[model samples]
Target: MKSNLAYLHSYKQRLAFISVSVAIIALSIYFNFFQKTENPEFSKLTFSETKTEILPLNIAKFNPNTLSTEEWKALGFSEKQVATILKYKEIVGGAFTSKNQLKKCYAISEEKFSQLEAYILLTDEAGKKQNFKQNKWVKKELIISGKFNPDLYSEADWVKMGFSERQAAGILKYKNYLGGSFVSKEKFKECYMINEENYAKMSPFLLLPSKTPADFNPYKKNYAKEKRIIKYQNFDPNLLDFEAWKKLGFSDKQVQNILNYKERFLKGSFKTLDDVSRCYMISPEKFEEMKPFIKLNPDNFAVNNVVNSNVEMPKQKTDFAKIDLNKITFQQLKEFGFSDRAAASYLAFRKKLGGFSTKDQILKTYNIDKELTQKLIQMSTLSPLIAEK
Candidate 1:
């Protein structure tokens, strides 16, 4: 009995020792809780006595479909929105055509394009776009023979195709505008969609073509889709020599003017037929007649009325015109308080990005202001193009 009692006493001593040790350990952990911050992003947190909660850019980027609520929060996606996105991804079987297409996801608002932009793995978008672009198809090549053979595109072919001699010459000269150099019949077809039968007729010698699996028209994708939507900026004032315009009710003169202006201006919009007619020396009566027949750009239209209208209030004038938004020299934009670098950036974006869509688009630039954009627009309005005869 004495031995058992001694053993129990020893066990009690050992338990007491362990209890005290555990209490010490617990206190240590509690006192130094802030020391647990060890992430690289948290390294800077030490600089301040008050710790900052730093968000880390995951080394392995998050997949929106599989992201947890916490991860979604990092991307500014609410829990409900994240769940909806996942459900949508499941519906499409994990196939996203493009990041742009993701905007169609009911849960992802168009406003989210920038919010979740960081988390999006554009590998899928880029891969899909590349696949579409590099897609192969059988095509026809139309090599014209005879007088136009030097260019391998003949005036007779153009005329038979319903193209006038001048229009034919324009087509030849417009080769770069059409598609630089044709690799497949499908591409050339787009440039000559107006005369498909004529293109098909000459297409035999132009060569019935095919694309290899690796083939792609690099420059073909450079132009925007809306560029070829219509015939021309100015329509001929007389009558459309072809049936498309006749069936459509546009006269040749109107069609010619539209074509001439579109080619001349480069930018697609015509504020009024006067812009085109004035360039061609056409009368106001003829201009007004051609107005209804002419199509002004629905989305993009401009008038150069934004000028110095201070005919009387020379001193009271406040400048509001867009500095020849297209040709505003970098040096001048700076005087208007635009930093040289930022002004340069705007210039480059405008040139490479087709054309100035709206003053709002420019205002949304990284460092520009809404007020300044308004001022800029009022200063320089877009001009109508005059064809070089």
Candidate 2:
């Protein structure tokens, strides 16, 4: 009977221990997850909202075109303002040539421009050109000699070569943003700061490539390396988003130029690989590198073309009298009033069906109509190149 009493007492202690353990576990769960739901202040203690830090503005003489994004922020502009300025410069094809040009940026307030105007250093070439146009100054030539590669020269080197601090900084900034080294002297000349006189002075000392001057076209050859044939990726530039473009190794500036060209020049369309090739900013090598990957869609092209057109007819229809439809690229289709996407679509269709036997086949293409096909038939001819292909 005494043993039975001891066993009962031990059983009670075990039950008490189990109850305490369950209570502790329940409390732990309540604090871990349920506490956040039950207690708002506890949730706040765990996670804080993210805040953007604004930099203090420094008032100094600065070139809006040349300033890095960080430098713009340091000068008191917000991150958004900096991005706007950069985009403005990019759309306008790099660098503000005049004080008035800087004023045109939407982000720049009158008060801000006024405060920064005194500090802004206009390139000597630009200043002189504007002055000459205004009858305020005459231009002259300066001659000098030194061994220098303008592409490789630092800001200090430019300063030693008689450029002002601001001019030197502008040149370096421009080169840095260009994404690659200058392949020729002509490219360096395109700098807003570098005028004919300055170029003449620097030309003798500048190290040039071994190729004949005739061989180096600045617009076509932006890279220093020889062109290598690369296998094309299956993609379409017209349909590519920003991230996709960046993935293709295009510079930010180049990508922006493509977007700008689409909106402004091409009327929000691309008509051909040729149209893309015509973007002088894209070097021949780069275009060739991309030629394989660009897939064109015609339906998208047709819709945009119809929507964007103000005139009764496309402007390039008259120009295609001599162009062979079979021989021409989809870019040529753009001449026949097709949007880039439409042109590409036609080209893609032609490839898939082996070749167009008649203009009637075009009606089967997405977004292509009988009247447009007839007009294309009237405008185009079969070329020997088409037969070969």
Candidate 3:
């Protein structure tokens, strides 16, 4: 009976020991996972909430190289996260060249990267052939059938013209960087992704002009004797009558067109010699021939009195003070006797060049005449900073 009692006691002790072991394991698990820690940086989110935070709600195929900050935000990254991603890209040569490279960014956790893995489009050794095949299939499906103006095309329009979405985005980004439009087919072809095959396929359908106006040579063909014989005379184009224009070697039709253009566009009289040069009927060679003889005096209205009484005479400002070209304002330019168009042109050109380095640079401005250019050089001085630069 004593032995039986001892056996019962031993069995009870073993059961108690097993129960304590189980309890200890349960407590360890609770402390490791469920219990709040001393670490303030540790997230207290539940497993489901943690999953929600890591995985983006929206998933779409996107090139990491072209994603803007807002686009990254749209993909569920915080501002700081997006900044980190962009900094990573900049450190790695301004673009994410591969999905694996993007996955290495610390801003994107392993879970997040795994979630985004399939949606990331990048050209890498492993995927290059597949992407090429996919792009080929896309091009075959979307054939460019009709003529299209690249200047007017948007990113979507370029995609429809057989360019991949990424290529279209790149084209548009380059176009915007080049003041929002491609000037010529050659300029469009200069895009980094545009290959000779692509350019050849698209060139015939591109509705852009064959050559820029500056590149076109009117004298390429031999001119007739009568067309070549232009009389040189000092005359204001604004004051010239139809007979006077005819005497200048223009045909009757060309003379009438010039007169009508002046009446319709110029509000009766030309404001500057540049206006006269801009007449569509006048060729570049013809304008160059007449440029020296085309005298435009805004202050003198004796010709206006004889021709049209409705013409308003511009105020004359003969006295001038030497001004700083770098500090000159648009109003100051106008006060210094520059026409509104000329003043605007100078400012625009100045902006494009990031301020002129030399007085001769002013001569490079479009619509500015030699007379005005000379006056500008005589009256203006460059800032010390600009001169030193």
- The window of 10 residues in a row where model 3 has the poorest summed lDDT is 311-320
Per-residue alpha-carbon lDDT of model 2 for 1-389, expressed as tens digits? 99999999999999999999999999999888786778768645665786544333655555454468888877778899989998998786665555777788999887777767777754444453434456565443222333667776655456555576678788976665444466556666678888764664455456865334666544344443323322347875667656566666677656755565455456656778887886635767678777877887764563644433331222233344555666666655554446565677777777777676765666666544334556556656654325224
* Position 212, candidate 1: lDDT: 23
What digit string (tens of lDDT, one per residue) describes model 1 on residues 212-256?
Answer: 225454455324432344334454322233354433345654454
Error of 3 at 172 (Å): 14
Give TM-scores for every candidate, taking all chains together and pairing residue i with residue i. Answer: 0.19, 0.26, 0.29
Candidate 3 per-residue lDDT, tens place, 257-302, comes to 5765565445557778777776656867678878889887675334
Return the clash pairs for model 3, or none. none
How many times do residue backbones clash in model 2?
Answer: 8
Best by TM-score: 3
For each candidate, C-alpha RMSD in Å?
23.1, 27.0, 15.4
Q: In model 1, which range of ten residues has the least summed lDDT?
A: 306-315
Instruction: State the displacement of the C-alpha of residue 124, model 2, in Å, after optimal TM-score superposition.
Output: 30
User: What residue runs in model 3 are displaced by over 4 Å at the alpha carbon?
Assistant: 1-61, 65-104, 109-236, 240-275, 278-311, 317-327, 334-357, 360-389
Model 2, residue pairs in steric clash: 57-76, 61-119, 270-340, 271-340, 272-331, 297-341, 298-341, 298-342
RMSD of 1: 23.1
The model with the greatest lDDT is 3
